[model samples]
Every structure is written in structure tokens, then in C-alpha cells.
Target: MSNQHFLTLQDIAPQDLDALIDRAITLKAAHRAGEASPQFPGSVMAMIFAKSSTRTRVSFEAGMAQMGGHAMFLSPGDTQLGRGEPIEDSARVISSMVDIVMIRTFGHDIVERFAANSSVPVINALTDDFHPCQLLADMQTYREHRGSIRGKTVCWLGDGNNMCHSYINAARQFDFKLHIACPEGFEPRADLLENNSDRVRVFHEAQSAVEGCSLLVTDVWASMGQEEEQARRAAAMAPFQLNATLLAAAEPDALYMHCLPAHRGEEISAELMDSPATIIWDEAENRLHAQKALIEYLLKTA
Candidate 1:
């Protein structure tokens, strides 16, 4: 794990990613039964958060405690990283003191640069370019509900943002196909689309994109740092909302998922969000278990 990082879904071997999903399911069951594991006692993980978070912070901190380790939270205000210190310098200092590091930040390049200079494994908790950790929980949730996602069609109906980018990578790593329904200017990184052409498709029509898909996912149309553009995005992305109509376009039993903090009635309808049939709650809970397996894997392998 020293040389390895979890900045992207591609960072973890495809086979290993599957294993991590299964392991996360196992860990979830164990946690519910009051099992305590001391697999990584005394381990110290540094949590660097440039962006605000609820799930990322709580899951990582709680997961570390459950695994007999400690997590130190470092927001921009609390660290030298915020005071204009070079990323490489901060990485060298923090990695030297910690067993591992996880960062949720603005730019994907921030984590890449930090990982390049750090000695310990650096995990991208979240980034403007990808949200791989959430995809881990997502994969686990899908695995629990319908078994392997390989060969399945997943409809992503929203901005081709970080979550969509992760799904693009997930389509490759997990051997699935993805349909991205985004507005003209909201498409994901062009290189990702070009690189994964065989497994990915883009469309402006949600109905057309979701046709015959097994799973449908979306996120807030305007993510953090885009508050000023919310109204504009809302207008442009109106057609892509995950309502019953769009859901009906997919397979009858298709699962609808939103990587929470959903804008109900915007990217997704409130009825669908609260529907018992959907597994969004399970998806959210799996964040802790999936991250625990990730931490265990990195520390044990290193």
C-alpha cells in the first residue's frame, strides 16, 4: 500500500475492488453483531478536509475507532495546508507522522500531488474529479442487493460531475456499462468518455439513456462550491431529474440511488428518495464498513 493509493477506482485492482466490496459486506454484518476487531491497533490516520463533509468525516473517524485506530481531523483552518504551505511540504510532514492519510478537497490534482510526495498511502476521500470512496460503498450496496454488477447497465441521470466520473471508472473496473444523461455543457471529462467509449454512452434524454438499465444513480446538480450556479444548473438539468417517470424508463426492478444530500424534486424526486424499495440508506451506511475494509487492506498490505 506504500506505493499504492486510492485516488481513483482504477487505483485499486479490479479483482481487489470486488474483494473489498465483499469484505465490506462481511464487516457490516460483523459490526451489527457487536464484534470488535483489533487488526490495526495504535494506527493513526490523518484526515485532511479542504471541503466540508458529513458522511466522509463521520465514516472515516468512526471506522478508525471501530478498527482500534485513531483519526485526527485536519480542516484547512487547522493545518499548514490552509496557510499557503506547498502541498508537497504538507504531505511530507503529515505522512511522516501518520500511518495513512485521507483527503477530501477541491481539485483532484491536490490529492495526486500530496500522494506523490507522501510516504504513506493517500486516499482520496473525495475530489472535484472523482469520489472513489463513495463508489466503494455504492458497489457494496449494489452487491448486497443484486449480486455482482458486472455486465449490468447503470443509468447516471445528472451532471457529469465527480460521482459520474467515478461511475465511469467503476464501469471499467467493475465490468459494467454506464449511460450518462447530462446537459450539453455538463458532460464529464472528455478523456474519460473517449477512453471508455465501449462501456459508456452519453445522452441528453433521460428516458433514452436509462432504457433497459438495472440501476440508476444521480447526485446534486450543483455540487459544493457551485452555490452561485444552483439556479442556472437547476434550469438546465430539469429534464434529468430522477422521478417515477425516469425510473419507469429503466428496468422495472431497477434500483434508484443518490449519493445523498440529494436535492429532492431537483436531481431526484422526494417520493423516490424516501421510498422503502430504494437502498439509499443502506448505501449511506455502507460507507463506514467499506472504508473500514479499505483502511484494513492498506495497512495490512503495507
Candidate 2:
């Protein structure tokens, strides 16, 4: 095993990714059966958040406790990094004191620099450029409900933000076809799309992208830091909302997912979010199991 950093879905090999998902499933079952493993007894995970969170913070903190490890939360106000400390300096200091580090921040380069200087494994909890951890949970939930995502067509029907970029990575790593539908200015990073052109396609109409797709997904119309643009985004993205009509165009058994903290009636309608086709709750819960598996993999591998 070699030291590694999970900055993106592309960080791990296809086989390892598959194995991690399987491990997450097994761990989830064990958890339900009241069998907790002390895989990282006495270890510590330092969680640094420049960006605020609910799922990322809770899931990682709770997962660590369940695994017999402790997780320390460091907010921007509490850490010098927020007060102008270089990312490399902060990474060196924090990683030395913890067994693993998880960072949820703005720039992708922040995590990159931290990982470059860290002594322990680094996990990208989230970033403006990619949210790989969420992708793990999404994949696990899909596998649990459907099956292998390979060869399946997945439609992303909202802001081409971090989640969208991670989905593009997922499509390539998991061997699936990704149909991304976002408003013109909201399209995912051009370099990312070009890198996985064979596996991903972009569209301006949600209906067209969802057609024949086995999985349909979306995110909030305006993500964090884009709050002021909510009204404008809502108008621009109105045509791309995931509603009953749009969902109807997808495969009959198609599953709908949202990374959540969802804005009902914005990116997706409330009725549609509550529909039987939606597996968002399961996707949310998988975050715990998937991340536990990830922590175990990183620690053990390291």
C-alpha cells in the first residue's frame, strides 16, 4: 500500500474504487447489525472547513467516532489558515498532529497544496471545483438501489458546479455515460469535459438530457458563495428544473438524486423530490458508510 490523497474520483484506480464501494456496503450492514470496528483506535482526523457544511462535517465527525477515532473540527475563525497562513504551512502543522486530514474549502488548489505538503492522507471533503466525497455516496446509493453504474446513462440537470465536475470524473472512472444539462454559463469546467469527452456530453435542455437516462441528478440552483445570484440563477435555470415532466422523459426505472440541502421548487420540485423514484435519502445516508470505508482504506493503505 502507498500513501495517497483522495482529491478526486480519479485519485484511485477503477478496481480500488469498486472495492471501496463494496466495503462501504459491508460496513453499512455491519453498522446496522451493531457491529462497530475499531479500525483506527487512538487515531485522529483533523477537519478543516473554510466553507460551512452540514453533511460533510457531521458525516466525517460521526464516522470517526464510530470507528474509534476522534475528529477535531477547525473552522476558518479558529485556524490561522483563515488569517493568512499559507496552505502548505497549515497542512504541515495539522497533518503532523493527526492521522488523516479532511478539508472543505473554496479553491481546488488549496487541497492540492495541502496534500502535497501533508504527512498523512488527505481527503477532499468538498471544493468549488469538485466534491468527490459526495460522489462516493452517490455511487454507493446507486449501486445499492440499482446495480453497477457501468454503461448506464446518467443525467445531471442543474448547475454545473463541483458536484457536476465530480460526476464527470465518476462517469469516466466508473465507465458510464454522463449527460450534463446546465444553462449556458453554468456548464462544467471546459478542461474537465474535454478530458473525459468520450464519457460525457453536455446539453442545454434538461428534457433532452434525461431522455433514456437511467439516473437523473441535480444540485441547488445557487451553491454557497452564489447566494446573491439566486434570483438571477433561478430565472436562468428555470428551464432546467427537474420536475415530473422532465423526469418522465427518463427511463421508467430511473433514479433521482440530489447531493442535498436541496432547494425545493428551485432545481427540483418538492413533489418530485418526494416521489418514489427519488433515492436522495439513501444517498444521504450512504455518505456515512462510504466515508467510513474511505477512511479505513486510506489509513490502512498508508
Candidate 3:
């Protein structure tokens, strides 16, 4: 099988993207049924994390274990790459040992440069510009709750951070419309917002963007490495919170999703977040199944 890199949603064709989500749902059911579904027995995945995380680390490591594979945890302090060694050299050396690699880092270029030199499949666990892995779990959760997201409308609330960026790419890959409601200075990448203008729309008001939408999603007001700006961001994004009022305007069965580590009463309201109707927990758990399917897809094809 040829080496494939999952750096972004565009890396996979639309049909294959849908296939992966369906496979993830199947894997979840099979696991719950206690059926044998080992696809990567004894495989090794090198997880390189330059940034800190709770969901990303736990989900990937747990997913590898469930698939009969080993996952190595590497921090900046644990490897030479953290000490200023070039990523190209590290990528060449690490790829030779591991069957697959996962990187959660600060910049998008780091993953791009590493994949260019690696001989094995590389997955972008998370990057400042895109969190494609989270999107995988999110899309899988949406598929499990609703049906296909094709032609449906999804609304995103909060800062135009990595999650927002991934949603933009998902709009194109999943054949859906995305309405992003963010403050003026917090909008997503210019090229992305412009390149997919027909599929994506940017709004400043949450109510205006979410009305009649089928799904609503949000993330923290201040992501990691941006703690100092939390106060200011809270003030600017206060008016865009996802509360019951916004939900009332959305479709009756519209589901709410958050990529875990949510800050209640900030980007989203506590009342809605704690409500039994929220699918955030399912979205979080899908990270394990979706990533297992992803690892299987990459290694089986490799």
C-alpha cells in the first residue's frame, strides 16, 4: 500500500471521506458488541505533541491500544526535535521506525514539512491552523446522530481558531454549508473564506447565522497559548454565545457539538451545555472510533 498523509480534509476524496465516517460508525458498533476487529495488530504509531492536550492524547493512545497497536508519547522534552533539531531529520529517523505517525503541534508547516520527508503515513492530530482529526470525530458523530451532512447547514460559534478552520474544510469535503459567527478580528483564514465563498458564509451575529441550521458547534474562547488574551476575547465574543435563544431559532432537532474542553458561559451557555439534548459527549467518544478507523485506513492502504 502507498503512503498517504491525512494533513487536511482535502487530502481525502469526498467519497472516501464519507466512507471513513461510515466505517467509524461501524467500528463503534462492533466494539460495543465485543466483536474481534483488529486491523493493526502490533503496529507502532509515534505521537509527537508539541502542544498540550487532553482529548487528542487520550483518544489516539486509547485507539491504538484497542486496535492491538503500540503508541509512543513524545514531547519536546523527550526528543531532539524539541531542542531545535530540524523536523526533516527527525521525520526521516522517526518514520523509519514507526508504522504510522501523529503530530499535534503549533504550526501547519511543521506537519507539511515532516510529511514531505516521511516514508510512512502521517496524521495531523492537531495544528494551529487545522484540527482535522477532531473534525473526523465531529463528522462521525453528526453521521450517527443525523444522516449524511450533504447539503445540510451547520453553524459555528466562537473564535475563528483551529476548529473553525477545520469546519471550513469540512464544508467542502462533506458537501455542506457552513455559517461561521465570529467577531471582526477573529474570522478564519482569508483564502479559505474566499476560496469556498459559495459553501461558507461569515457572520457577526450568532442568531443570524444559526437560524434554521441543522447543527451548531463551538469551542473555547481562548485556546492553548492564548491565555493572556482570554479576558479581552470574552468581552468581544460575549454577544455570540450559544444559548437557549439561539437554539430556539435553529431547527427543532438541531444538535449541538463541541470539540471538548469547552468553556461554559463563554462560547456556549452552561444551560445548553449541561442539557441532556447535547451530543458533545458522543462527539468526544467518537474520537476513539474515528481515529481507529483512520489508522486502519492509512495502514491497510499502505
lDDT of 3: 0.92
lDDT of 2 at 56: 92
Where does candidate 1 clash, by residue pair? none
Off by over 4 Å in 1: none
The residue-by-residue lDDT of candidate 2 on 1-302, one tens digit each, is 23599999999999999999999999999999999788789999999998989999999999999999999999989889879998889988888899999999999999999999999999999999999999999999999999999999999998889999999999989999999998899899999989999989999877788998999998998889999999999999999988889888999988889898998888889998887766899899999999999999999988
Q: For residues 86-105, could you state the per-residue lDDT of candidate 1 as single tens digits? A: 99999999999999999999
Off-target runs (Cα >4 Å) in candidate 2 are none
lDDT score, candidate 3, position 156:
95
- Candidate 2 — number of clashing residue pairs? 0
Evaluate all candidate structures by whole-model CA lDDT and list the values in order. 0.92, 0.92, 0.92
Give the TM-score of each candidate: 0.98, 0.98, 0.98
